[model samples]
Target: MADDRPPSGLRSLLRDDLRGESPYGAPQLAVRAALNTNENSYPVPPEVVADMLAELGETLPGLNRYPDREFTDLRSALAAYLSRGGEPIDPVQVWAGNGSNEVLLHLLQAFGGPGRRAIGFTPSYSMHAIIATTTGTAWTHGRRSTEPGRLFTLAAADVAEQLGALDPHLVFICSPNNPTGTAVGLDVIEAAYEAAPRAVVVVDEAYAEFARPGTPNALTLLAGRERLVVTRTLSKAFALAGGRLGYLAADPELVDLLRLVRMPYHLSAPSQAVARAALRHTDMMLSTVGVVKAQRDRLVAELTALGFAPVPSDANFVLFGGLADAARTWQALLDAGVLVRDVGIPHYLRVTAGTPEETTAFLDALAALGPEHHLGTEKAS
Candidate 1:
C-alpha cells in the first residue's frame, strides 16, 4: 500500500541541508583520566561555590519567573573583567549566549545566509563547519602552508589571497586552534581583515587564556574595527565549562544588531549567579593559567621523550601526529582507565593536560605499551 502523505512544501535549501541532521550529546564519561574535553581537572573553590549557592538561595523567590530579559548585571561584570583597566563599557557592545558556540551561531545568523559564504582554515574547531552548513551558508576552507619537514602554519599572504578570491561574508579564525592548538599571528588576522573589508571577521579565541607569552589577543584589535567580532568562553580558563557562559565583544553597533536577533531571557538566573561569583574570583582563575602552562610544557616534554610527535601547543590540550594506531592507542588508554581523544585523522591523537597524578598515569600507560607500539617519527622542523 502506498503511503498517502502530502508532498513536502519545504524550501529546497532546508531540504538539502538539514533533512537528516540530529542533535549531539557530550562525550561519554567514565571513571578514568578524562582528558578529552579540555576541561580543568580542579574543582571550583569552596568559597566560590558557597557564595554562588548563597546567591542562588536568595534568588529562589524569582526562580518561578523568567530571568532578566537582558542580562545587564552579568554583562557588566563580564565587560569589566574583559576590559584592560576595568573601564566602563557601553553595555550595548556586549552579547551573551549559552556558550561561545551559540555566540558563533548568532554571528553567522547575522551575516551569513544564501549566496553568502563563510570561510575558515582547515582542521579548525569542527563546529564552525557544522554551524555554517546548518545555516545554509557556503563554507570554504583555506589550505595552511606546510613545507616538507615543517609544521602546519597559516600564511597571512595566502589567507589574503584566498579572501580576495572568495569575498566571503564571514571569516572565522580560531586562535590556539582546537586539535592543532597553535595560535594565529596578529599579522595574519590583520591581513585577513584587510582582505575582506566588507565582511565580518570573527576571531574565536576560546582558548585565548592558554595562549603563550607575547601572543596578541584579538581584543586589542577590536577597538576601531566595525566588522570585527571576538568570541570568548568561561569554559576553558575559568573552569566554568558546566556554567555555560559565553560572550562576544564587538562594536556597539554590531552588538546591538545581535540583540535584535537573539532570544529574550537567554541566560538563566542560576547561570548568571554562578558566572558572577566566578568572575569575582578572577585572581584564582588567572592563577590556573600559569599552572596549565607549566603542565603543558611538562606534558610536551614527556610525550616527546616517548617518541610521540606532540605539536607546539599554547592551549591546555596537545596533539600528537605519530600515533602508530590512534584507535588502538585510544582504546588501550581507555581500557587502562585513562581516556584521551582520538581525532580519527590519520595517526593523530589529542590529549588534554590533566592533574599531576592523571598525567603520570597517562605516561605510565604509554610506557607499558613499550617502544614497539611507539610512533617515533621525526619532529616537524
Candidate 2:
C-alpha cells in the first residue's frame, strides 16, 4: 500500500529560510583517482596508527562517562603544535569541535544570530554562508576582485569598503580559499579587522599547513586583536579527517565564549584520544605536506601547459578554468576513473593535489580529452 504522506510535509515543518536549501557536500564517489574533495591522498602513517590504537585502549574503558568537555589535553597539544613558528599560544586560547564546520557554527551561534549580519567574499567556502544563515545571522555575499585575468583574489580595500557598507557582526576570510586555492595576504586580514571594530573576524585557515613558506598565519595577528580568530583543521595536512578534529587559536577571552554555544561532551572519547595521538606524532602525520605542495605546484604548471587557466594556489587543490564545459569535463574525467569538483563555476573545476601518480592520472585524463575540452582557441601548447 502506498503511503499518502504530503509531498511538502518536511518542507512545511522546516524553518521557512531552510526550506529550499540543499545540504552542502561533495560527491563521495568511488573512483581510481579521487580528487574531488581535496582530501590528502596519503593514508595515516602506520606509526601514528599504532600509537592511536594504544591511546584508544586507555580511552575505551571510560566510554561509559562523558569525554572531557574541555578537551584539555587536545587543546594543550594543539597549542604546542601551533607554537612551532615562534607564535606561542596558550591552551586557554584554544577551542575545538568535531570539525572546523562546527567551530564555525559555534562562532555564528555565539556572535551571529537574528538581527546580526556576517559577510564573506564570494566564491569562498560555501559553508560560511550556510552556517551563518542557520544561526539566524544575515549573510552578505561580498565581492572578490573580478578584474580581467584575476581569479578570485580579494583586495584589502574591497574588504574595507564592504565592511564599511554592511557593518556586519562577523567576517569570514578563507586563506588559501576553497575552489580557488589562493591565499589572502595578511594585509587583507588586518583591513577586515580594522573595518569592523565590533565584528569577530574569522580567518579559516583550514589548509594552512599546505601554504608555502613566508605566508603569514593569522595566528600571528592574535597578539593584540581580541576579535580575530584563526581556525585550523587536522583533516588535510595531518591525514586525520576521519578523526574529525578542528581547532582555532584566538584571544583567551574570545575562546571562553564558544563554550556557551557548543554542546556538552562535543568531542568524543575516541575522537579526542585519536587526535591527541596524531598530534603527538605531528611530524610523521604531516610528512606529506611537502609532497602535497610539490604536487600542487605541478598541477599549476601542467594545467597551464594544457592551456587551462590554473589559479595560483597555496592549498592542496587547484582551480583551473579554460574548459569549454566544466560539467562535461567532470563527467569525462569520472568516466576515465578520475574525479574532481565542479564548484559550480562555469568552465572551471577544482581538483585535489593527490599523490604524484594520481595527479598524473588526472592530467593524463584531461590531456586525453584534447582540444575538444578547450575553450576558445587555447590548446595544449
Candidate 3:
C-alpha cells in the first residue's frame, strides 16, 4: 500500500518570519542574583495571593466556562487605578492582553503591516523591531542625537526630521526606556506625535512607576490626542510579572479597533483575579517601588564611583559603559553567579536592581573586577 501519512510540507509552508526564532531563556535557575530579566526581586505579597486564591475558589463556577471575553471588570479596575491620583481615565478607552508584548503586537496589527512602516529609536527595546519584522512591516531605525552611551536622550529635531521624511505608519517611544532606564521628555514626545500626522505614536510606559514625581504621563496627554496610545504593564511595579497582565489606554475608537483583533478569552480567569487583587493593594506595591528606587540610586552612585560611567536612570535598572568585553564580563559575572544583561553595544552592560542582598552580591562582584574594566582601557572589541 502507498504511504498515507501526510508529508512534512506543512513546516515549509509556515510563516517565514518565524522560521529561525528560538525561545529567549533567562539565567534564573543558574544565577545567584537573577537580574538578567527586569523582574521584581520581591515576590507577590502573601495577602494578595491569598485573596486571589479565595476569589478563584468562589468563582469556580466560571472556571468551567470561558472567561469574560471583554475582561470588562479588569479594565474598569485598571482605569480606576490609573485615575486614582487625580488623573481621570475612562474604562471604555482601555484594552488589555496576556502581556504588554501582546498589547503591542495588537497595536502593530491594527496600525502597521506589509505596506506600512514602523520607526523606532535605535538601542531601545529590541522587541519593537521583532514585532515589526514578524508582522511583515518595514522597520526603520532613527539614531538618537545624543552621545554614544546615551541612547535615551534622542533629539526631537532629529526624530521630527525623520518623521517628515518617512512618515512612518507607527512610532514607538519607551519612557524610562528598557536597558538604558532614562526618560524622554514629554515635549519631545509631543513634538514627535505632532510631526507624524498620519502615523500612530505608541508611548510604552512599562516602567512608569519608577519615574520621578511630576513626570508627564502619556495618560495626561491623551485628552486631545487621537493618534496616541499609552501601553502599560502590571508586571513591573505591581509585582505581577508572573501574572502577565498588560493594558493600553488610548482613544476609545482605537481601543475598539484593538478589541476587534484581540483573541477571545485572552485573559485567564486566575490572571484577572490576581491582577485585580494586586491593584486593590496598590499602596503595598508602591512601598516596594520606594525601596527599589532607593536601591537604584545607591547602585548608580557605587557604579559611578567605581568608574563604570553608569547612565542616569529613572527606572528599576541601570545601564553603564566601561566593560572591556561585555560578553566576557557577563560570563565572569555569571561564573561568580551574578546574572546581568549584555547589550552587545561594544562596552555596555545593563544590571537590574534587585533586593538589597542581591544588589550587595552584584556590587561585590563588580568591585572585585575593579578599575581595569573601566571604559576605554580594557580588551579590544
Which candidate tops TM-score? 2
| Each prediction's RMSD to truth | 4.2, 3.4, 4.5
Candidate 3 local lDDT, 1-381, one digit each (tens): 997554367756778676657654455566689887888889887887788888888777679888888888899999998897577899998998888999999999889989999998877888888888888889998777565754558777877898889989999998987778878888878889989998899999999999877777778888899999999999989878888999989999999888667787888888888887888888886679988888888889999888787888889999988787788788888878899998757788999889999899999998888445666765442
Instruction: Rank candidates, lDDT, best first.
Output: 2, 3, 1
lDDT digits (tens) for residues 1-381 of candidate 1: 996554366633466566666654436677568888889888888888888899888777899999987888888888888885343455677888998988988888888978889999877887898888877899998777666444657889999999999999999998988878888898989999999988999999898888888888888788788898889899989989999989988899898888766777788888888888888888886677777778888889998987788889989989886676788788888888888887657778888887888888888887787454555532331
Runs in model 1 lying further than 4 Å from the true structure: 1-14, 19-26, 85-90, 148-150, 376-381
Residue 73 CA error for candidate 1 (Å)? 1.0
What TM-score against the true fold does each predicted structure earn?
0.91, 0.96, 0.93
Which regions in candidate 2 have their CA more than 4 angstroms from the true location?
A: 1-7, 377-381
Ordered list by TM-score, greatest first? 2, 3, 1
**lDDT (CA) for every model shown?**
0.83, 0.92, 0.85
- For candidate 3, the TM-score is 0.93
Candidate 1 residue-wise lDDT at 105: 84
